[model samples]
Target: MDVKETAAYLNVSVSWLYKNAVQSGLVIYRFGTGVNSKIRFNFSEVEAWVKQQRVMGG
Candidate 1:
């Protein structure tokens, strides 16, 4: 997903993803070069990470 899609999927602000997605190990994929690069996310990986972040058993 793209930044906006990802932000919506994760229910977070786009800026938060820009600031923290990499650090949180979300497996960011960058397209193109420089600061204008477009970023995408792995849906399954993101789901896994979200599961991993759980503090209690479901």
Candidate 2:
């Protein structure tokens, strides 16, 4: 999904998602640097990460 879609799905701002989720490695994906470059995220991975964070009281 696009950044907007991801942000809406997570109920967070786009900037917040980029800073917190992307920068913090809470979600895993690739950053493109060329014409074919794109951002991608796995919903399952994100969900699992969130659950782990909650369990760890983060």
Candidate 3:
């Protein structure tokens, strides 16, 4: 899904998703280039990562 869609689905701000998820390499994907660059995420991946984070007390 798109960045906005992912952020909405995760109930988080777009900026938060970009910073914490994308930049941190926690739960995001990048495609295209420059202004065309897109951000997407897999819901399952996000869920699993969250679960791992919880297990790790992060």
Top-TM-score structure, candidate number: 1
lDDT tens digits by residue: candidate 2, 1-58: 6667777877889888867875656654667787676667787877776666665535
Query: Is candidate 2 or 3 superior in TM-score?
Result: 3
Error of 2 at 44 (Å): 0.7
Clashing pairs in 1: none
- Rank all candidate structures by their TM-score, best first, as comma-separated numbers: 1, 3, 2
TM-score of each prediction: 0.87, 0.62, 0.68
Instruction: Tell me the whole-model lDDT of each prediction, alpha carbons only.
Output: 0.90, 0.71, 0.75
Runs in model 3 deviating more than 4 A are 23-25, 55-58
What is candidate 3's TM-score against the reference? 0.68
**lDDT tens string, model 3, 3-32?**
788778778898888778855556557788
Q: Please say which candidate is ahead in TM-score: 1 or 2.
A: 1
In model 1, state the lDDT of residue 55.
Answer: 98
